[model samples]
Target: MLSSGVLAGSASVQGPQGEVAQFEYSGSMLRINAAQNDGYALLRDGHFYTVGYNNGQPMVFDAGAMLKGFGDMAPQAIHGDLGAEIASLKDTGENEVVAGIQGDVYEVQFIDDSGAQRSESLVLSTDKRAQELRDALFQMMNFAESMTPGQEKAKAQSQDIRARLSSLNAGILRYGSEVTVTEISGEPVAAQRFELPAQPLDLQGLGKLFGQ
Candidate 1:
């Protein structure tokens, strides 16, 4: 059930029970090509990429949610969260966690799971790439405000500035080797669809329930 002007893509995952897992799109159709056998899916639109992987039973992980989990950081939905100033790096608490200060660079710490210990700092940048990106976006917004002046020259300049800002930025930063980028058109994409059909319940059958 994909919409027009969109594509459908899918990926596979190896399950513990040796069952075949399929991830299908129910909204926009994604075209997948030149795939490897490493259970990875990467979709690209120009320089931007959206990636996801199949877990099992056609359950494809949401890219945004997976990004948050892998980065161990939340998206800047609110105004004052650390995400507003610095991007979150997915650390999984297995090795590190990211901390940020507004208008400054971000740092990572190798924190223990119990939150009782921390290792040395790992600074990502010095000039604050997050804040720089924010500023660039705001600059484009300001340029767009000029369109209300009713001046032809100002309007042209505003359009030029907006395009420059957009082209200058390549979208969100990425981390980790397992992450994949997907190509998606500008539209309301579905989160992901999945179902678990009913099957017989018994010990031996249950052992093979996953197709063992």
Candidate 2:
């Protein structure tokens, strides 16, 4: 529905600790600058880059390995594709205003990779502006999924969901309680915003920091 060009926006993400995080996206890149932490994350070009500061020293690392490592440490029972959990999506024929945009409400049913059932609600709009923003967000999601390990099944499921949404000419305005688009603009973003501030540290360099 977007005639052409890129969409820029910022969202408010509710953190687990009752704190809010700002998420900015432009084109295919998303940036999360932590407000209370010494690190930030950027998702660009099919990779997630994490930058952290230790005693005023900056360290850049690949996020894929960190995610895999976290998965390895988790209990096996919870090791499932979180992205492939959505089982169905249905329009509820209800309208709601989110962030000043009116959109139709939809219910999403989820069957976790472990087969547990859950559900959530989302507000979707068919506005051209919203569609442009949605496309940018979708691109980031695709890039993030591409870099994740062992996600082929989840990727397939995600593709199906994307197709279904596209068929309805819908774009997300709000996704349950997790994300809300607080502001949007058609402004141009600089290419350098997606560039890494420094080279990522190699595995050896990372291990050296821990005296491994």
Q: Best-fitting candidate, measured by lDDT? A: 2
Candidate 1 global Cα RMSD: 18.1
Top-TM-score structure, candidate number: 2
Task: Estimate the TM-score of every prediction.
Answer: 0.19, 0.72
- The residue-by-residue lDDT of candidate 1 on 80-130, one tens digit each, is 111121222332323322222212122323322244533222222122232
Error of model 1, residue 99, in angstroms? 24
Candidate 1 lowest-lDDT run of ten: 72-81
What does candidate 2's lDDT look like per residue over 110-172, in tens digits?
787578988888889887756766676576565555434454566666676677668888887
Model 1 error, position 42 (Å): 20
List RMSD in Å for every model shown: 18.1, 4.9
Q: How many clashes would you count in candidate 1?
A: 16
Runs in model 1 lying further than 4 Å from the true structure: 1-107, 113-173, 178-180, 184-192, 199-212
lDDT (0 to 1) per candidate: 0.28, 0.65
